[model samples]
Target: MKNIEPKIKKLTADILKDYGQGRTIDKMNAFTSPDMDVVVDILDKLQKILFPGYYRNKNYHFYTAENNLQTLIEDVLFNLTKQISMYLRYLPEYSNADYRTGMERAQEIAMEFLSRIPKIRDLVETSVQAEFDGDPAAFNKDEIIFCYPGMYAIMVFRLAHEFYDLGVPMLPRIMSEYAHGKTGIDIHPGATIGRFFFIDHGTGIVVGETTVIGDNVKVYQGVTIGALSTRGGQNLRSKKRHPTIEDNVTIYSGASILGGETVIGHDSVIGGNTFITMSVPPGSNVSIKSQELHISSKGRPDAEAKDLDQSATWFYTI
Candidate 1:
């Protein structure tokens, strides 16, 4: 009994040590970190500004309309500038001088980006129209604005893409990744998506960096606009690494269109579950045939009588 008591005490000590270690590790990676929550709050405010009356449920009297929005906008700009400065300070890629210059550049870029909000709002209105027109079950534009994950993803992408264009390092990707985590739509910060774009059931969609998608393009879930391979590191870094999809193209679910040189021409329809690597001409339809499955019953005389050649039975075209 004495030996058992010591063993139990030792096990309890080990468990307690592990618990304490876990708490320490968790503290280091806590979401309550100022950087993380500040960025998240900035995004929340941006969303509220982008889609008024959809996100925040604050009671504003008639007199407070202009003042409230103006205050919120100023707050967003100030917070964003501070966050950008803070992020640049922590990132090891930039030197002290470079960080200062980059922060200045980011400030200018952010101002330009904020200036484009009116245009973005117009684009989002088109997307809302597209959603309402595309889905029969959609009740109203308000529902799409309020509840749709696709709209949220697109909004973040548009904002992040602008930052990416302005040559801000890491922040755009971080912003887009935040949206990706929430919506399951993986739109790269550097992807060039045009106005009036719509992503239907946007989960699992991958728009790679350097992908140039033109106006009025629609992409469904599980579509991968990606690169085929990166043969060399230096060559891959600055070069185009994703497919160029021209205007009025619709890529359905599970379609993987890959390679830098690959271009989907204007007015094309890519069918669901198709794998494409080469260029497609304009006004074309690409699809993959459904695969067939065979089943054989055991302990049946009729099934046994059937000639089942192993090589022939296993092979089938998709």
Candidate 2:
């Protein structure tokens, strides 16, 4: 091949020039941002703490529960403190301070978060029970805790919510996004979800930020409890954008309950594939009018099948 050293140098110089340009993509000499791998490791350790016996690492030799917990908690605490400190340095209050100051603040927040473990566990237990009671396919509570993606998603959301509540920026959203990557359920850490929340067959579910869900609420797959419109963008930040789901409500699969003002009253059953932007009264069963179906045999003539297809917009009820 012909000499390519000059071409390589030219390409490198061009790429370096792009970096030098005054755009917002450079983090050249700033303090290190939160590491995704470390955040994932924190999440894994938190899982063990949250559900004690459900997820155990075979690599670690466990002599006793107390001994194992003591070790795991220290390891997780060190890493969590470091990660939180890194993110906190970017905040306005911590911006002028040194890394040590951030670490001090992080330690305080970490300790407070750790202290809430018992309450978190209590809420998680209710979630596990919710999954067990709601899903008929669940063999036992243990099975739901171990195998359900909904439980995993909700557990991570609960943990992240604590961080969100404490106002530790970036870490909570990272934790939530990590769980979202593993499970198709996308629950925003900013959402306020109450006790005994169950998510069934939770794939393609989007629980948006500022959504308020009350106790004993169960939602199925392909549900979007989201904002009616996001046209306002940052202008709508910190404002209620999603709907309020009251206690003892069941939102079925493929349901889109949008708008902040839309309140789903208690004891309501929102049927599958239903779209609601308006407030639903208590004990209301909201469903779309069933459409007629013309089932044609596969062996039927092509012309007959084509005729059946002319009745556009097919819908399935749940």
> What do the candidate models score in CA lDDT, each in turn?
0.76, 0.86
After superposition, the stretches of candidate 1 with alpha carbons farther than 4 Å from their true spots are: 1-34, 57-62, 89-94, 98-106, 231-235, 290-318
TM-score to true structure, per model: 0.76, 0.87
**1-318, model 1: which lDDT tens digit per residue?**
558988999999997677676554535534322376777888888888887777762655445657878877888888777666655544565436455585685577668778988877887787888777877778888888878889889888877777677666677888889999999999998988877788888899999999999988889999999999866867688789899998888899999999999998777788888788777655556666556222112222333224543223221243
Tens-digit per-residue lDDT, 1-318, candidate 2: 587999999999998988997778855654477789998998998999887877776678978999889988998889999989988876899988886888999999999999999999999999998999888889999888888999999999999999999999989999999889999999999999999999998999999999999999999999999999989999999999999999999998998999999998777788888888877656556667765221112232333134344323434332
Best by TM-score: 2
Clashing pairs in model 1? none
